[model samples]
Target: MSEGYQIRNQSAPHFLTFTVVDWVDVFTRKSCRDIVIESLKFCQKNKGMEIYGYVIMSNHIHMIIQSNDGNLSNLIKDFKSFVAKQILEEIESGGESRADWMLKRFEFAAQSNSRNSKYQFWRYGNHPEEVSSEKFLWTKLNYIHMNPVRAGIVNKASDYLYSSAANYVGGEGLIEFELPSNPIIDVLRKERFNFEIDEW
Candidate 1:
C-alpha cells in the first residue's frame, strides 16, 4: 500500500476496493459475502453512504460510493471494522473449516501492522479513486460490474447476485443507489440499462 491516496471529496462518488488480507478466498463462503452485503445495506440506510455500484468477489469487494453526509472515510472505517469483527466472530465460532488456518494468517497480518490489535481481516487502504468525469465514472462502473465475468464466475455481469449490476438492470441489489445526473451514467440508467444490459 502506498501513501497519500486519500478520499479527497467525501461528497463525491469514488471507486473503492477492499481486499482480504493476503488475498485470502474468505468470500468463497456465502456467509462471509453476506456479512459484506449486510454491512453495505447498513451503511446505505444509516451512515449516509450512497452505493452507486458494488461487487463482492472471492478476495475483494469493489464499490462506487459516496457519503451523503460527507464523511466517507469515517463511514468506510466503520463498515470495515464492523464487518471484520463479525467475520472474525463467525470464524471463531467454529463452523468454518479453515478457521484455524485463516485466523493464523489474519493474526500474522495483524502482528505486522501497528494499527490492528487482534486480527486484520481486510487489507488497509480501500484504494479510493475519485470519480472526476462521466466517462471515467462509467468506465469504472463497467469494470466493477464486469469483474465476476472476467474472473469466469459468471457469463454476464448482471447475473451476479452480489453486484449493483442487478440495480442497473432494474432488479434490486443489496443496496439502493442514488440516481446520479449530468454523467454518462444518467444515459446509462435511461437508455443502456432498463433490463437490457450493454456489453462493456
Candidate 2:
C-alpha cells in the first residue's frame, strides 16, 4: 500500500473504498452481493473485523472498520482478496448472464498486473482514510449511509437493504456495530446523530 492510503494505525477506525476492476457492475447480481456480505460476516466473526458502518454499491463497497487483534490492515487485505476470489468463482459457475464480458474484463485487468495469474476482479488499493476525530468519523459514516440514497436506489438511507444505516435507527442488520459502552457513547454524544438510541 502507498503511504497516502496505508493503514498506519492498525487498531484505529478507518474509512475505506473498494472498487471493482473496470468499474464493472458485478454486484448488481444478488449472488455477487451475497458473496461480499457473507465474506464480511465471516471476517467479523473469525478475522477480527469490527465494522462500524458499510454500504455495498453496484461496483464498489464503502466501509468504516477496525480490527480486534490490531491487524486492521492485514484483515482488510484478506477480506478483499477472499471476496475477489469467491466472486470470480461465482461468475464462472454458469449463472451470471454477463459472465463472458466480465471474465474478459477481469482477464484483461489481470494481464496488466504482473502479480495476478488468472483474473483481477477487484481494483488495487483500498482508498483508506483513518478516522482520527469525531467529526471525521460521522462524516464518513454519513457519506456511507447516503451512498445508496444518492444513487436513487432508496428514498431514505435507513431503508437501504445493504447498508449499516438500518442499525443506527433500531432495525435488525445482518451484522452489528459494537458501541455498547460509555466511552463510545460519549463520543457519539459529542455530535449527536439525527437518530436517537433508545437504550444502548
Candidate 3:
C-alpha cells in the first residue's frame, strides 16, 4: 500500500479507484460491467453504501463513496469479493471470449497473495482519497465524469452511459446516486479563478 492511499476516515466520503488485476480490460464486456453495477446496487440496498458519483471504464472504476454504517472498509471488501466471484464465474462458464487468457492472469495474480486461492480479479488497495472539502469533491466529480472524454470514449462526458455524468445534468443514470448540492457547485463556479475543463 502507498503512504497516502489508505482509507483514513471511514465515515467520510472518499474518492476511490478499483483496477482490474494486471489492468486487464475485463469491463469491456457488458456482462462484466453489469456485474459491477449489480454489486454496487446490492451494497446500496443492503450494506449502507452511499454513492455520490461513479464511472466504470474498460478496466477500472472510480467513485465517490461513503458508508452509512461507517464501515467503508468492510463494505468495500465485501463488494470486491462479491463482484470478483461473479465475474470469475462468468469467465468459468465461458461467457468471456478471452476467458482462458484472463483467468490465467487472475490465477497468476492470486499466487502472490494467500488470501485468494483460485483468482484475484481486482487489484488490492482502493487508493482512497478522503473528500475533505467541497472543492475537492467537485474536483473528483469532474475527474470521474471527464474520464471517458479523456479516453476518447465519448465526445462529451454526459454522453457516457456507464457514468453518473447524465445524472448531474438532469438525465437519468444507470444507477441511482446522491447528488452534490447545487449551492456548493455554484459557489465553486464563482470562486474559480482559472478553472479549465481540459485540466480535469
Candidate 4:
C-alpha cells in the first residue's frame, strides 16, 4: 500500500471513505447492502472498533471510526475482506442473477491493479483522514448524512434507511452505533445539538 493510503496514528479516531472498485453502484442492490451490514455487525461483536457514524451510499461508505485497541487498520481490512467474500459467494451461487454482470465489471477494474487477485470488491485506498479538529468531524458528519440526499435517494437524510442519521435524531431502532466522545459535546451539551428527526 502507498503511504498516502496507510492508516496513520491508529490510536486516534479517523474519518474514512472507502469506494467500490470502478465506483460501481453495488449498494443499490439489497443483497450487497446486507453483506455490508452483516460485516459491520460482525466487527462490532468481535473487533475493538467503535463506529461513531456511518452512511452506506450506492458506491461508497463514509465512516467515523476509532479502535480502542489501536488496530483500526486491521478492523477495516477484516470488514472489507469479510464483506467481499460473502458477496462473492452470493454471486457465485447465482443468488443475484445480475451479479454475474457486476462481477465481470469488477474483474475489469482489478486488471489495472497488479496487487489484486481475481476480484476486487473495494478499491485498495481507504483514504483515511484523521479527525483532529472538531470542525473537521462535523464536516465529515454532514458530508456523510447528505450523501443520500445528493443522490436524490431521499428528501431528508434521516429518511435514509442505511445511515446513522436516524440514531443521531433520537430514533428508537436502527443499526447499533457507538457515539464517540467529542470535546464540543462537553462545551455545548447534548441539548444544544438538539438532534431531532424533523430537523432534516
Clashes of each: 0, 0, 0, 0
lDDT of 3: 0.87
Error of 4 at 10 (Å): 0.6
Candidate 1 residue pairs in backbone clash? none
Measured by lDDT, the strongest candidate is: 3
> Alpha-carbon error at 192 in model 3, in Å?
4.9
Question: What residue pairs are clashing in model 2?
Answer: none
C-alpha lDDT of all candidate models, in order: 0.84, 0.83, 0.87, 0.78
Write model 4 residue lDDT over 1-200, tens digit each, in one string: 45875677997889888888878787888888888877777777789777778889988999888887898888888888888888788778877767778899878887998978898888877889888888678768767887888889898788888888777666532578756555674333235445443655
lDDT value for model 1: 0.84
Model 3 regions lying over 4 Å from their true place: 184-200
Candidate 2, residues 1-200: lDDT per residue as tens digits? 55678888999989999999999998899888888889999998898888889999999999999998998878988998899988888889999998999999999999987999799888888888998887788768778988997898887777888888888766567676674223464455335654444321
Q: What is the lDDT of residue 175 in candidate 1?
A: 68
- Candidate number with the higher TM-score (1 or 2): 1
Superposed by TM-score, candidate 4 places the C-alpha of residue 44 at a distance from the truth, in angstroms, of: 1.2
lDDT per residue, candidate 1, 1-200, as tens digits?
35767887878889999999999898998999999998888887889888778899999999888898998888888999999999999899987999999999999999997988989898888889999888778778878988998899888788898888877766566667664554456566546554235542
